[model samples]
Target: MEQDLGIALPLDYKELLTRFPGGVFRRIEIDSPVANEKAWTKYKRALDELLEILGDEDLEYLDKVDYTPC
Candidate 1:
């Protein structure tokens, strides 16, 4: 799936599955800042949407996560 997206997903992303098993899409941590604040905002908004969808689908799965952002 990552190959089709032309991106490589980190092995640990499976950790997210333990919490929100429906899964995430498109976003990844990167070394560089977004090109501009607008881009950063958009990125954050997208992540928020992903989290929202995951929450709606299944909250229990999230409990399986061993780690999460602080």
Candidate 2:
């Protein structure tokens, strides 16, 4: 992942994410893919599940969600 990103993600971040692999503070997602392949895959799968279960209205802010690959 660091090789793909051309940079090393902070050890602290990896540690935190490892311990708590889901959700950020108050459950707000950052809207951008991280420097980790597993994390990004998990996010996309979650979004797809949300859309399937909750429908399009749940994705109203998708335009505001950024997708610039790291």
Candidate 3:
């Protein structure tokens, strides 16, 4: 799935998916990096909604974060 996405997921994220393949947690919807077709579509929809809420200003602020590896 990571290969299909063309990005390597964080180790912890990979571990979490391994622990819970369906990606459900306490009945809350947590987007899975390894989601199947249906789950991926749902994830994308949620992401689009989140992006809409974030707007350009919020995204610019987020882009300024120092994502450098420790």
Candidate 4:
């Protein structure tokens, strides 16, 4: 998945995914600056709308955050 996304995920995380497949644990919480699915989707949609409203500069600003769009 990381390879398909052209991103480098942590080795431990990759191992965990390999071993568990479903996830590390049933209800594990990940706390990081990285945005989760819902937040990322919402942000991307908002950015797309903002690009229409505000133009390319808004996308450039968003790009500065260095998030990988899902």
Candidate 5:
């Protein structure tokens, strides 16, 4: 279930995903660095869940985040 992405996910992210199966990530348009970080900090758990699903090999429980098609 591992590919060589060469990027390390933040600590506790996996745990958060495992704990909350309903979590999700919000694709941020980082126009404002301070605001984006603050928002991300508040929704860190959701981001972790999104990462978990994206990284998971099991498709049974994996759910993609909803985004508008451009």
Candidate 6:
């Protein structure tokens, strides 16, 4: 993965992926082959919405953006 990304990954990240596959840590989801489906579905929807709002010029979304869902 580091070779493909052209960047060296952190040691902690490598440890976490190996030790906590498909698990959540500090409110963050770790991607794995067995990730939670429901959580990912909601996450994807929110990400798409956020990207769309950011792409919009007149939405004034930055000031109104909320992170409670996260």
- The TM-score leader among the candidates is 3
What order do you get sorting by TM-score, best first? 3, 6, 2, 1, 4, 5
Task: State which candidate, 2 or 4, has the greater TM-score.
Answer: 2
- Judged by whole-model lDDT over C-alpha atoms, candidate 5 comes out at 0.47
Off by over 4 Å in 3: 1-7, 23-26, 29-33, 56-70
> Each prediction's TM-score against the native?
0.35, 0.36, 0.52, 0.30, 0.28, 0.38
* 3 against 5, candidate with superior TM-score: 3
Candidate 5: tens digits of C-alpha lDDT, residues 3-39: 2235665557655644544433486433221234555
Residue-wise lDDT of candidate 3 within 1-70, one digit each (tens)? 6665577878987798778776457897666645678877777677668767666554556577655222
Poorest 10 consecutive residues by lDDT, candidate 3: 61-70
Per-residue lDDT of 1-70 in model 4, one digit per residue for the tens? 3443467979887666455433225588433223356644554566568657655445566566655343
**Model 5 deviation from native, Cα RMSD in Å:** 14.6
Candidate scoring better on TM-score of 1 and 6 = 6
Residue 45, candidate 4: C-alpha displacement in angstroms: 12
TM-score of model 6 (CA atoms): 0.38
Q: What overall lDDT goes with each candidate model?
A: 0.52, 0.60, 0.67, 0.52, 0.47, 0.61
lDDT tens readout by residue for model 2, 1-70: 4564467989987777666645466778653346367767766677668657544544565456555222
Error of 4 at 61 (Å): 16
Instruction: Candidate 1: give the clashing pairs.
Output: 19-61, 19-62
Kindly provide the TM-score of model 3 when superposed on the true structure, using C-alpha atoms. 0.52
Is 1 or 2 the stronger prediction by TM-score? 2
Candidate 5 similarity to native, TM-score: 0.28
Clashing residue pairs found in predicted model 4: none
Per-residue error (Å), model 6, residue 4: 18
